[model samples]
Target: MRADNSQHIVEAARRRSEYTRSKAVQALRALDAAGEPVTFETVAKQAGVSRSWLYAQPDLRAEIEQLRAVQRRAPRSSVPARQRASDASLRRRLETANERIQRLTDENRQLRAHLAGALGEQRAARSHTSPRGAASMHEGVDIADPVQPQQPIREREQ
Candidate 1:
């Protein structure tokens, strides 16, 4: 008859269970500390244990559920509440941007009107200098170069 060795086998099983439990607890702590999501799958993977085994542990299961709930309720942003910009600050920035856009639009409109008037004056000067039925004096002139008026020379009175 074989000698009874059930006691030794039972002792080894208990030790294995204790070791596994400790590993799961450590994994839970690590995940919580790192601000990572605390799910049973995550804890099981980190601990190198089976999900079924983690679910069987009542204390760990409860803690995991509580942490998961808390995480769901908490904000997901990495930035702390104190460092976030206020609503008023955002609104003021938007208003300033809009004002700058309006000012630039007005400036662009005035510049375009001034350019049109100068081009009209240049065309009139070209027409007056060219006789009827003759080629225009400004035929080869580039429109981009604005026409400058010749200043009248004032004679000094002796």
Candidate 2:
């Protein structure tokens, strides 16, 4: 009776071990398929095990994850690769655009400075000229000899 009971226990333990290992593999595969880094919590949830249990089996975790990585790179799909390349291209384009914007901004500042200097010089020249006040006076207004404004000039001997 004792021998039979021990055999039964061994069989049960073996089955449990197999079940746990299969679960770990499936969890690892799912994580790899998602194209995301695996975490203990995510693996535990996928495997239907406690996080502590998953962590306790380091060798199994490493082995299963290694296999998952191999499977992930085995000519499966091109979507991730294309997305990576596009992301790199977008980053480069953004950097180029920023540089162009900076250069244009600098050029605009220099142009503004030059225009201001030219305007200042023009203002200084205008201010230096004498004001022409008598240009708008009426032709009939006489400045000298107001009473006899039309009389001819008379010469006197010294």
Candidate 3:
């Protein structure tokens, strides 16, 4: 009688083992069909088994390692497009700002040179004038000759 009970228990355990193995295999096939990475956690979760079970199973553990290796060797060239576009925009804006700054700097230098030349000419004219007229000439406002006031060099150029 005891032998009969022992055989029954052994048979039941074997059936349970076969069911677990079948579940793991089915999960692995589904993952492969979906082109998903077959890791221990993924397989265990899909198969409704514990992670320890997968780790303890030599075949499953080896398969998971092989899949992980394949994942590492796979080519991944998926960069975020928005980030690339933003970087390009930042570069263009920086170039434009630099160009504007260079133009303004050149304009400032030209204006300074023109101011120096005008001052030099005024000094030479003062040297040829009488002292009485020279003192009055330095004033920007022409009190006596307001009818025909002096025009600036920029306006004369136009």
Residue 32 alpha-carbon offset, candidate 2, angstroms: 0.7
* Candidate 2 lDDT over residue span 1-158, tens digit each: 33458888999999998898789768866665675446667777888988777767888667555644644665454233214446678899999999999999999999999999987786566556524322211243323334533332232112
Rank by lDDT, highest first. 1, 3, 2
lDDT for model 1, on a 0 to 1 scale? Answer: 0.78
Q: Scored by Cα lDDT, where does model 3 land?
A: 0.74
Q: Could you tell me the lDDT of residue 99 within candidate 2?
A: 100
lDDT of 2 at 71: 45
Evaluation by lDDT, superior candidate among 2 and 3: 3
Comparing 2 and 3 on TM-score, the stronger one: 3
Worst 10 residues of 2 by lDDT: 133-142
Question: Clashes in each model (backbone N, CA, C under 3 Å)?
Answer: 0, 0, 0
What's the TM-score of every candidate structure?
A: 0.48, 0.38, 0.45
Which residue pairs of candidate 2 clash?
Answer: none
Please name the candidate that would achieve the greatest lDDT relative to the true structure: 1
Which regions of candidate 1 are displaced past 4 Å?
77-158
Candidate lDDT (C-alpha), each: 0.78, 0.65, 0.74
Worst 10 residues of 3 by lDDT: 75-84
